[model samples]
Target: MLEELYRQVQCPVLAQLEIGVTPCALVFLDAEASGSPNLRCGDAFSYVAQAVTLNRSLLNAGLPQLTIATNAIDLVDDYLSRLDAEIRPAVFPLRPSLDLAKETRFYGAHFKLDLLEQMALTLPANRLLLLLDTDVIAQHGLDPDLLRRCHASGVGAFDISDQEFSAYGSTRVIDDLELVAGRPLRNPRWFGGECLIVSAEFVGQLVPVARACFGRYRAVIPDLNHQGDEAFISAALNILSERGQAIIDIGAYRMVGRHWSGSTHRDLRWFRGCALLHLPGCKALLGRQANRRTFSSARLWRRLVLKHELNRLVWSLRLHVQSRRRDKAIADSPEAPSQTW
Candidate 1:
């Protein structure tokens, strides 16, 4: 299944670069090192949730062999130990040479985002990469055929709600975004990387662009509670899309399958192909105990959109209204005040 996804997602890059390699998913975990007191930031409970979800989500998706690079190696090991044999992940100490840890400056959240960009660079430039946030986990299993939309060549990003130009606290993010794209950033769907899929071919070029954007962001935003890496990533995607790269919006490809959840509610919704879940701003979840939770005890709140016409009509209307409201917010947004952490 992974090989199929690999072939589908990397095909475009391969055609361009004319390079080939074995097909396999190189899964990675990027999170704040809460176990290291010096690097810790945000609620420890949230990190706990991220780790716990990573383990269970991978297990549920039947994906194992996760490679981790973190300051909190021991803590990650503890969580992986809980997973059964086939699903247990392996931990790797972060390479010092790749140590882009910027905890000294950005808040823990920023540091994690920086780390995520770094991890994208460190993956071997010969295989497929599945870079997931600690907060995102598998809501259900994966079927490669069902993931066809996500499998198309180049870079694929999750569709997220809170991704407009105003999404970032630092106004610089928006400015940098426009600068990168060489035009006003315009997109109805905000590009999200929480569960990002990248072909090795683009990573080499992607890192520098992301790093430049990150540097510009850090130079401007002088505080903790700023938006994470998604904005910078959006900048990269905008650039790539302009360059004729196959940057697939996973949500649109899957049509009604994969949905983005920016709400913090415990309620879960599943579309036909909805596989992974991103827990972004749930007040009940974040800034608190990310304490490792049990996946076994949890049950799917909803699954496979009902085939009824009434239900489908209602869902379609709700989505249209939500999209309109979001677009209006971004379009009507006033000039943002500059921010300092």
Candidate 2:
């Protein structure tokens, strides 16, 4: 059998791999109230473990400079304190915990936006801030070229999944933005908030725009669910787009709500050339694993063992062939697909 991958999720520390240099800060907000369901599930340990895992991944990805925002620092304090004394200072608070529902016009979305807005005030216009969910696990640190492309585009999200308006006729999102901006702006694309890269130039307006749109959306929608943050981000990007600003979609191989949903051979999405793995809408480590128990008990998974084994052999052979072909091409020419990483 092939050896398991060099997955950051399993081991927090990685031998630093050489990636082209790109200076940027990776920020993660892991603030969860003590009463949160994740805490109730006794999953705090895993949450802290994932945070360390992600931190180590970033360090190896040529991005050792990390800024972490969390209110539950006590939960991860042990892990954080174990790092070099000099490194502990990077962990800070996500402040002004107002009626988050009132401040950012949404619950989870605006709290992050508010914090980001404040961070942008001091961040230089030349640098880029890659704001990500604390739950995101990176097998690869990040492709420097991917980040450069995202930075060049001004603003970028992990993927663009939402079309103009989803089923709910969620005009409230746009309406709130219009009320704040005092003008109409078009929201064309839906973004995945699991991860976003913002250039200093656009941060100033993006945060305020998302805040304004969400704040008044409460009165307009009246019964809005504190669900996806992408809706708020989409509004802000729409306004930016109207004024000739652009946001790029840094597509990934696949995204799944339940982390283990695509863990088998039937889910071809897992085998693609994915850049990262994201559990965007997840609120807890236990939640990402919820599918594991069910998947393990599935009749198909049990009955199709032989078929799955054959699929694995075929997939492995294809990868081997591709690698050999690329290696041969590299021997013949300086520029080849081998540099894709």
Which candidate achieves the best lDDT against the true structure?
2
**What TM-score goes with each of the models?**
0.58, 0.58
For residues 115-154, what per-residue lDDT tens digits would candidate 1 score against the true structure?
4445655555444466665555554554443234333455
Off by over 4 Å in 1: 1-46, 78-88, 95-106, 109-127, 143-152, 161-176, 179-189, 222-226, 254-273, 281-294, 297-341
Clashing pairs in 1: 45-288, 45-289, 45-290, 46-290, 48-290, 49-290, 50-134, 222-341, 223-341, 264-282
Residues 1-341, model 2: lDDT tens digits: 22335443443233122223222222323334232232345444455444544454455434554566554556446566755553332565556443444233223444567556656655654456666655554444555545555566667664443322442345744454455444666554556665677766677778777777666544444444333356566666777778887666666423212132222423533422343445422335323432232222123223234344555666677767978987787778966445454
Q: How far off is model 1, as Cα RMSD?
A: 9.8
lDDT of each: 0.49, 0.49
- The count of residue-pair clashes in candidate 2 stands at 1
